[model samples]
Target: MIAIDNKLISDSVLEAQFVCDLNKCKGGCCEDGDAGAPLEIEELNELISNYEVIKPYLTPEGIKAIEKQGKYIYDTEFGWVTPTVNSGICAYGIRDEKGIIKCGIEQAYYDGKLKWKKPISCHLFPIRIQKSQQDEDLEYVNYEPRQDLCKAACKLGKQLKVPVYIFLKEAIIRKYGEEFYEALAASAEVVKK
Candidate 1:
């Protein structure tokens, strides 16, 4: 583990290669999970604040689900999460013509409609950040690739020689600060020796 402040980042995040091959996976992570994408408290507020801006990018079903379930829902195990469409795909997920699911919030951001992209949890997918139960100040940054869904991404990452941390650079920088990311990179360099 690479310890920086209160967070312990997994070695797998440094050693393993992983990049999302969206074409191959078709955004399976967005649709196949037991629950919708986890949302931070700020993200829940963003959804509520910008639902109107994001609505046009969503599918009919997704919009309907959001309308019925509110902007987000509380999950016992996961805390706040985006509401799912009929308990299947996420309400914020928009399926393109090619059937690849995409985050409507992200799409809206791409179109310059909103400043907030998507849930940070969704942004840092495969790398989950959970607060340690034993210590309030501690959080674990774990690289948890789902074999059933992430085969193509894993294989492609190996082929491309991209380390998981590098693959998730933007996300890591988003969650942690740039200095923390530099710390992680420095740790990776030391570990490589």
Candidate 2:
């Protein structure tokens, strides 16, 4: 583990290569999870605040699910999460012409509708974070590749020589700040040697 700030980052995040093969996975992560996308407390507010702006980007089924279930729902294991349609695709998901699922919230952000892109948990996919039991102040960040869904991504990552940390640089920086990412890069350099 590489310790930086309050995080204990797994070496796999620096060693394992990954790049989302959206064409292959077709955004399966958004659909196959047992629950909806995990949301931080603040993300709940962001969804509520931007619902109107984000609504247009959503599919009819998605809007109905959100309307019936509210912006977010509580899960026994995941705490607060975005509501899912028929307990499947995320409530904020829409399908493109190619039938690939896409995040409505992210699309709205790309369209200049909202400042927040999407849920941090969704952004930092394949790297799940949890509070460390060993230390109250520290969190554990680990690479969790799903074999069925992420096979193509793993293959692409290895082919491109892009490590997980580098693959998820933007999301990691967004969650932990630029200095934290710099520290991770430095750690990666040491690991390389």
Candidate 3:
């Protein structure tokens, strides 16, 4: 594990390769999960505040789900998460012309309707963070590779020689900071050697 600040990053984050292949997976990560996308407390507030702007981009079913379930829900197992439609796709998800699920919140951000992108958890995908059991104030960041949804990404990452850390640079920097990411990048180079 590479320790920086309060985060303990798994070595797999440096060794594993990944790059999302949306064509192959068809954004299955958004649809196949048990619950909606995970959300931070602030993100939940953002959804509530920006619902009017985000509504136009949602599907009828997604809109209904969000209306009925509110912006976020608490799962016994997962803590707080965005609401899901029919217990499948996230209520904040919309289907593209290609029939692939996409995040409505992200689309709104791209359209300049909102300042924040999608939830930090969704942005830092395949790298889930959890508070350390031993130290509540500390967090652990790990590369979690699910073969069914991410096989193509793994193959592509290997082909492109992109490690998980490098592939997720933007999200990492967004979640942590430039100095934290720099430390991670430096550690990745050492691990590579």
Q: Say which candidate scores most in lDDT.
A: 2
Q: Put down candidate 2 lDDT per residue, 104-189, tens digits, no spaces.
A: 99999999989999999989999999986777888999999888999999999999999999999999999999999999999999
**lDDT scores of the candidates, listed in order:** 0.92, 0.94, 0.90
Question: Which stretches of candidate 1 lie above 4 Å from their native place?
Answer: none
Q: Model 3 residue 138 lDDT? A: 100
TM-score of candidate 1 against the unseen true structure: 0.98
Clashes of each: 0, 0, 0
Task: Give candidate 2's TM-score.
Answer: 0.98
lDDT per residue (tens digit) for residues 7-48 in model 3: 999999999989999988888889887788888888878988
When summed lDDT is taken over every stretch of 10 residues in candidate 1, the lowest stretch is 40-49
Candidate 3, clashing residue pairs? none
Residue 172: error of model 1 in Å? 0.7
The parts of candidate 2 lying over 4 Å away from their true place are none
Which window of ten consecutive residues has the lowest lDDT sum in model 2?
A: 130-139
